[model samples]
Target chain A: MSNKVIEISNLGKQYRLGQVGTTTLSDDFKRWWYAFRGKEDPFLIIGDTNDRTKKGSSDYVWALKDINFSVNKGEVIGIIGKNGAGKSTLLKILSRTTAPTMGEYKIKGRIASLLEVGTGFHPDLTGRENVFLNGAILGMTKAEIRNKFDEIVDFSGVERYIDTPVKRYSSGMYVRLAFAVAAHLEPEILIVDEVLAVGDAEFQKKCLGKMKDVSGNGRTVLFVSHNMSAVNSLCTRCVYLKNGTVYSIGDTAKIVETYLSNESNAESCKVWDPSVAPGDSVARIISARVTDDKGLTIDHMLRDQKVGIEFEYEVLQEGHWPIPNLHVFNGSEEYAFVSVENELEYLSKKGKYRSVVWIPADLLNDGRYVFGLALTTMKPNVNVHFYAENVLQVEVIEDISKRNTSYNQRLPGVVRPQLNWETTLLSD
Target chain B: MADMKTEPDEEHWDLVVKPKSSLFTLNLAEVWAYKDLIMLMVKRDFTAIYKQTVLGPLWMFVQPLFTTAIYTFTFSTSAKLSTDGIPPILFYIMGQTFWNYFADCLNKTSGTFISNSAVFGKVYFPRLVMPFSVVISSLIKLGLQILLLMAFYLYYYFTTDQLHPQWTLALLPAYLLILGVFSLSLGILFSSFTTKYRDFTFLLTFAVQLLMFASCVVFPVSMYSEKVQNILMYNPVVSCMEAIKYSLTGHGLFSWYYLSFVLLVTFIFLIISVVIFNRTEKSFMDSV
Candidate 1:
């Protein structure tokens, strides 16, 4: 037995497209009239899958469709999806805030969600009063809140002003107190969505630490966020959602890679968005990527292996030998190398172009590196068309097991070269 | 399909979500679990309202006090309505406290959706706690108003021979019980209607005011014609109010017949209201 806590099968949620849900009152009456006579729901027959990009024929759309996933005890699972991809809707259903339109999910523990912090906080209530009120709202009994009362006050760091109304507290103090109350909640299954965006960096760090502590004690956590790094560090596995359905669900790194790759504004590879591209109307970088020797984009590369840097851009009014420049820098703000595409001068069309620059293996030291890219005209004033700072980052690692060098100790300098090194002892 | 076998091994799951629950299932255990929320909501209503007000909870008594004055001026002196020969202030205070409690419970509950949409939208608790807490808070206010009535009763007892404690004073618990149940059920029923058709909320305001005239609030039923008396006697609030009056001031009727009739009506209303409330709780957030 996996000690499963949640099991969802064929789960779906169909929502009406706009404000007026499920047709007009007259049509709803007709639908109800038909249902009263044992006929199928007339509207349900016409509803379609929810894809907002394209106009569908039906007025009803499935916000979540045919989703199936089970969660075991103590699993810290990250739910990552684009906006309107039904991430919130799924959490809503799991938290029982709303009923599912189709299918069912069985949850085998007390479930709580930090859909929003400090929910149902009365402004007039003191910080101490709100703690108890918010705790009870999250399903903690009075005795449970009392038992954790002192610990809660201590964690909030507003012990001196606990008796003061929360409206009098600063925004940071408000968040600390709100987070402290939520942090004390220890349900068997916890669902958190994007609440970490609040508070300062230090408080955010504290909350993340608190969450780590909670999950460490074998509680199932369902976290949803667009912050991929946080998810990568905290989540053991990830469920990648696309258009209201599970696209993939697997190890956190792989799922994050797939999810980021799908995004046009990825950390390492940015497929051009017309509205957000960095260049003028003439020419723009459409997409950029850090790839390995196999020509597949990767987030990290072994330092001993050669890697390819590729950029695909469109030259609208082509001319002037617009070359793509690549600047590689290690973590210490030192440039490892710089490369610019050497193109034939002033000879290009008004169409798409692909540029590839390969960096050889065993040349750079093992460290975190970034690619700062620029598209510049090679003539006249040497105008920079687009200069994207830190456009992509890659981690280079040297595996000791795969190395043939006798030198295992630390070495200096920004670059590691497999150069010829031999010693001759003639006097001996 | 193989995962279904795990069900037998784990019979201690705390929650189970399904597309549908049995229609008749009250699921009172779920309601029982949220009792703290109910109490906290009661405290919220009590304390949150008086945050900036100068008089604070003193307003709870002042409300019924002024209403009694208006009823005494308009109904006693202006309309020459009889209060079973009891003093006007004491009689009106007697009826106003209980009726105001019931009316406020119903009125506030009628807007449960519009007022608490914030709390309701983000969280999942037994939605009945909202209306239940509304009644308890109003009940607390009523308790305060009763203290005012006691002061008037004591003055009338010493100054004149108009007040006397009857054996029926022992039935105060039953009277409050019947009144509380009847008001809560009726309030919840109206609250259910407001969720679907908000037009009822406007109607509820004026309708409650109009119903108060037909009720035994300002005057005792003994003063009305027998035909009118029998009709007003059917209202549970009428018998409950009359019993409270008879217990304290030794005026008005306190018959088992009226008490049993009110009990039956309250029981039926309770069942119907609970059914509607549970049904509304499922998807009220959708429309509301």
Candidate 2:
């Protein structure tokens, strides 16, 4: 049987950005008046296509525009994009949670969307009741949930709390129960958002295993997540979105490489103007930059080259001995290391101060990594004044041309330790 | 989830989503497929109301019983409202029981978009199921409350020579169906409207109270002036509530002509509300 599940074409969703708390009654009147004329909506003409970098000219913006892709049955497709790149919007449209503003998509077979772990879980309900309730919400029949009832409870490992209300369960237990019910869903087409990075690490492994079991059954899956490593392992294909449009779509590895390299290339250096300095009056991050030893702004550096992160901040208060810190997370969003300067000598005064931290050569793995900075007063009162997450990103790619060994592949880990190896022949 | 068993036509697409969706696409199959979910929602709404309460489901019976006493005191005693030879307690309990069913459906379904926005945004189900569940659960409550009305009914039937039931009681099933659908239609219409503008929520509570008076729930339609009766006749709910009274007591016109007119109006109202609801379901998450 030739198996194909989904075919989407020219899909788009436009949103009107404003103070949505209360729209004037006149706007409703205008919309009705224009809708009656059989003309294109009067507001649609004023919509600027969604490009977050550019200052939009109108209140209307397309959350997803002209998105086109097709999935053969059993293909696990990963969708990766930046915060505003419309990944969620595309998933919403495909899952039928929300409709596209334009164009169409043809879908075969039943589709169930696990957009979040517990989309419809009622906290007051018992865990067992929530299992049935959530399963039914995800398009499962009562018999299906009943048959999988024990398996779901066993998978969640919350048997003791089965009869207790979900609200009484800890947050981790709540996620496990919610995810257990979600895992029992066996729809032909499954659409999942970034709900996998929850619970303990072991449950996440079980979830990934369950997803693998799903696609192994020749079921099509659409997964959206910012976790690149998870996508790299689970997806055969990938769709990269940029500003509400498809930037690229193809092999998972190639598309991921393209998304990471292109994304970091544009964000190697970040500057916060005085108007938009993202901090309270206590302190403000002026600039954060990733550079090489030669002081050149670099998106790509040799695996052995020293990487430098320089963060300049303007402190506007005294008695605040601020500790500037950096947290490095690898491409998979795992925290590689955190380096905070806690030297007791420097009492931070009201002035522009810059802190530069350098990483030794060959210390980090040959992969993409991002920087997060925080300014906190950790003395009498440990209060975090400001923290800038993902201030800069860099890629430490292996130089293939300079390889000597037969195997010239990058190793996988948070860091690559280059320790001296002593190999003396024992019985020469 | 049920399997889609048709042969895979690689060239043929199953659904085409366009900017202008077909307005009348009810997709009853999709709704039916989610029937289990509808039942759970109804169960949840029914039980969730009485959870941790002292009286539990007894509150359902007690509410209408107490309201009957209050209404008899206010409308029958002070205002001297006539009950057409039926005793005041039995009359008011009957009116309140039936009107509560309609009012509950309208109140709950009207807030469907706002209240369920959290679940609705994260997942996709036939949005009609929410209001449909409201109607079903309200029917369940109505069934429970009807027992209290029945007690009064049986008391009045044996003791009082005034009670006279008509053969139109056979039409009670059809009347309830009309009443349920009419409430669903209006509730869904208001639900769709409240998604964008919240002004209707406040208006709805007041409007339902006004609707009860307009339907002649507390007073006989014949007691009104001719011009007022003409206006009340145009309200489909008047036909619905009056038909119920006529069925039980056989005191007024049990006219099939008026009942059919009410059904037609309800059918039209249902279609219009469904259109508005379908459109809102697609993009209400954006504005809601």
Candidate 3:
């Protein structure tokens, strides 16, 4: 039998741009008139591609247009996109919370979508009651919920408070109970959208583990989330959406790399006008740049080249002795390292100050890196003057010539530094 | 084309989502498959409303009892409305019991899309399950009110020779069945429109109040002229309510033609409402 459980083709959804009012009736009339005369919908041809940043002349926009992909049984597919790229819209259509305006899709077996957890949970209801209520809302039968009632309670770890109204439970406890019900849903095709954004770190880990277990049982899963690391670890394949259209669909690593690299535009130098620069009364970041040792501002460099992050800031108020810090993050948003300069010999008059930190050659992995700049004071209390999260982004490319090994492939670890080694051959 | 060879039977696919969904798609089987959900929703609606209350479920009896008392006080002596020789308290309670159920069902089910939009937006089930559960939950409330009515009913039957419950009392379930069908269908239809437009909500609240006066809730149909009676019987709720009153007190109008007319209208409205409701559920998320 064919393993492809879901087949979507040429799917699209068109939405009106503004508030529904007088224009809706006219549009409806126009649509009716066209249909009556055996013509096409007049507005269908006039929609702009959905790009929330830009204002378009047309009153209609295609939130998703011409989307086509198929998922085989047991394959975990991650849908990643920038906000308003139709990620949620696609999931809504796939889960049938909404219908597409164009094309069709066929699916085999049951599909359960958890676009949100605890959708129908009543605050006055006890956690035990909410488990059954939420499970039913997610399409579990009473028998199934009954069968897994104990297990769900055990998984949520709120058994002591099961009979207590969820209103009294902490938000963490509530989400745990809700996700517990969702995690126990054994559907053939599960479509999840960012339910892991809640809960503590440990709970999130448990949820991800449960999702992995779900997919391991020969079921198809569609996951849509902004957490790149979660998508990287959980999904085997990915579909990257840009401006409401499929940009690429392939192996998770390649698609995620394309998504992350394309997302930030990889700026090496960012300069701001002093008046509008990001800062408090203490200090303001004037400019930030990433450069190679040759002093050329660079957005990409070979792994063997030393990388320098330069920040220029003005201290508006002086006596506090401000410290400049650089926080480095890899492509998956995991912090590689944070470097803080705490040595300032004396507190002096306010003026422009520049700080630069050099990352050693071959010390970082060959992936996109983001630099965050912060000016802080450590006096009686620690206070951040300003922190620019994504001041500069640089891609470190692999240098094939530096390695003599037969394997010319990417190595594991956040930093792939070349360390001095002594190999004493023991009678091999 | 390749699918035709690889999967010869398209029926092998469990679901086929299409742009042009058919209008008459009422998946009774799908609704049946979600029976547990429907029952759970019913329980949620039933139990959740009474939570954190002093009276709890006892409040169910309070509303109808007070309404019956108010109706008897206002319309019994002051308005001197005819009840066809049945005592005013029993008459008012009988009508109030059935009317409250019908109105409660309509009122709750009619707000299914609006009231449950938070839950509806995030999950996918047969949207019909919402209104179906509303009807069932209101039936449970009605069940409680019926017991209250029976208390007054038995007292009147014992004391007054005028009280005579006909053998048609056996058809009480049938009357309630018609009532459920009418309210469920009409409520579902109203809910479909209420999803997009706010006007229907105001109109429905106003219309339901007006509907009670039009139906034989507080007064009997016998008090009206032939023409007005003919017009009143056209309301499916009128026939169902009068049939219930007749089965209980044995004096209200119970015509076979009118009952069947109620059935027919209920049947037609059920089909249209389910179709419109199905279509509404598809894209209501956008407008809602």
Candidate 4:
């Protein structure tokens, strides 16, 4: 027998993007006419692959276009994408929750998907009843469910409330029971969405471990998640998606790195002007740019390198104002450091003023970071100025050549604390 | 952990991406494979309906019983309508019990798309199983009401010197088969329509009630003129209900031609229902 468990070719999904009503009827008639004449669909020609992001002249958009790939047995793949990138649509099509608008695929084994937690659960039903209901929905036979019932209950940790209605249980308890049922379903292929985001850290770890065990048991798994760390740790390979199309499909680390780099470049260096800013204030942040001391724009920088943020603004009226301040933030959107030059107060004696905020070397740790800058007037009120949020990127790299320090040192929050620690034992 | 030092084969386990299937079959055969799920859904519907109620399954009998009482008072007493000499209670109960089954099936199945849209939206299953299970569960209610009819029949039979109905009673199963097919067809047809034009939901209850009156549930169709009788017999349910009473009590009307007509109509309805249901299943998720 061939090792391939699933094979797909030239798969595409076309979706109509307007109110689905009379338009559907007319479109159906047009599709029928084309089919009757043995011609390709007229509406399909309106969408071009190169400009997939652009809205088509017709209401139809190909959510997935020419998606071709094959899956051997026992492979775990991660689908990584930004929002609205057709990731969920692809999973939905594979799980048979929906069908593709075009193309065909053949599966050699049964597939079970956990697209959403508590999907098949009825809130009014008890957990024990929902177990069977959801299991049955997942295509498990009664004997299979009976064999795995105890393991499912034990894994969920809701033994005490197994017979209680799910509506009465906490959401965490509900998700646990739902996941347990799905995890133990034993389908040949398993598909999971990013529903683990709702669970706590410990539960997420448990779920990820269960997923690893599942894939290890020679079953295929397709996982969709925005958590790059989890994707990198769990998946053997990943498909990166951008704007409803496949950007790249390859090594998990490389794809994730590409995705991160693209995101950093897109949002990091933005040319701002008075018209583009949101707020109507005394001062407006006209432009903000992150660069090295040599004035070259950079998204990745060394941990100990000096990073500079250039800010340009045009003052509406000439007056004394507080000096510009810059704040650095990490991926979690938490502010890491705020540098303010309050003592060096200056007035906009001219039409426009330019300033640059600098961070000295060795002040940050290794990770991706964002920068925010504000130009506030200090005289009238603290907030009388322009403030930009999360608009710059700075990445810190650690030198792997160094061997004196442990590589597993803890990195917490947006900033790494550079505090020194010393230990001594006291004797009686 | 058992083989912690073993070098896992990383090259062979790489992710394989593929295009998704364009065509999907609902596989009613698979639904047959999961027959236990059908039974469980039926049981859940059966138990949950009356679980917390004080009267429990007693509510099943109460509906037909009260409707029978009202029919007996309004048509038998107030209007003094002829029942073709069969007892008023037997006639009314027979009509109410049989017609209620069909109505229940129609109403429940018609609401299947709207009532369970939330559950159906999140999960993938043979959507047909839902309405099929509803029809089966309503049959249980029909079975209970039939028992109540039998009780009244026994009381009237043993009390009076009237002879029990002849071997034609064997045809009762035939009548029930016709009713089942007719109701299933109408129910599925209405369900397919209600998935889109939800205004049908508001009109459904009133339509069922008006249909009950027109189907001769309150009185015998024999009481009407020949012109009206022909018009009423055009409704397949009227023929099924009249056939049921005729088989049980040896009273009102029985015509092989009418039964054949009803069978033909029922077959057409069922074929149409299946066609519409098949078409609706493909894209109802989008519309619903």
| TM-score versus the correct structure, for each prediction | 0.81, 0.87, 0.93, 0.85
- Listed in order, the DockQ scores are 0.47, 0.45, 0.64, 0.24
Cα lDDT, all candidates: 0.82, 0.85, 0.88, 0.76
What tens-digit string does per-residue lDDT give for candidate 4 at B224-273? 99999998998888888887777777776778899999888888777778
**Best-performing candidate as measured by DockQ:** 3
The candidates score, on chain A by TM-score, as follows 0.72, 0.81, 0.90, 0.81
Q: Which stretches of candidate 1 lie over 4 Å from their true place?
A: A21-24, A39-42, A265-428, B1-12, B220-224, B253-255
Interface Cα RMSD in Å, per prediction:
1.9, 4.5, 2.3, 7.3
Per-residue lDDT of model 2, residues A245-266, tens digit only? 9999999999998887677633
lDDT of 3 by residue, A1-428 (tens): 67889988889999997797213877889899999999998888888998888988898889999998889999999999999999999999999988889988999998999999889889989998899888888888888999999999999999999999999999999999999999999999999999999999999999999999999999999999999989999999999999889999999999998888788743799998988888998789999899888888998998888989998988888678778889988988788899988668552458898888999987899888988899888777898899898769998898677686878787877777788889998997
Q: Under the 3 Å rule for N, CA and C atoms, how many clashes does model 2 have? A: 0
Q: Per-residue lDDT of A192-257 in model 1, one digit per residue for the tens? A: 988998998988998899889989999999999988768977999899888889999999978886
Residue A323 displacement (Å), model 1: 15
Answer with 2 or 3, whichever has the higher lDDT.
3
Task: For candidate 1, give the DockQ.
Answer: 0.47
Number of the top lDDT candidate: 3
Worst 10-residue stretch by lDDT in candidate 1 chain A?
Answer: A259-268
Positional deviation of B59 in candidate 4, in angstroms?
A: 1.7
Better of 1 and 3 by lDDT: 3
Candidate 4, A1-428: lDDT as tens digits = 45777666667777777677323777779989998999987887775342454665766677778776667789888998777778887887777655666776667677778888776577677888888888887778778899999999999999999989888999899889988888897888888898778678888899999999999999999899988778878899888877667789898878887787676533547776557773344566677777898998877887667888887876666665646888787654456888886445355554566788787766676777777777776666665466777777777776645524676663545565456679788985
Candidates 1 and 4, the one with greater lDDT: 1
Q: What is the C-alpha RMSD of each candidate to the true structure, in Å?
A: 6.5, 4.7, 2.9, 6.2
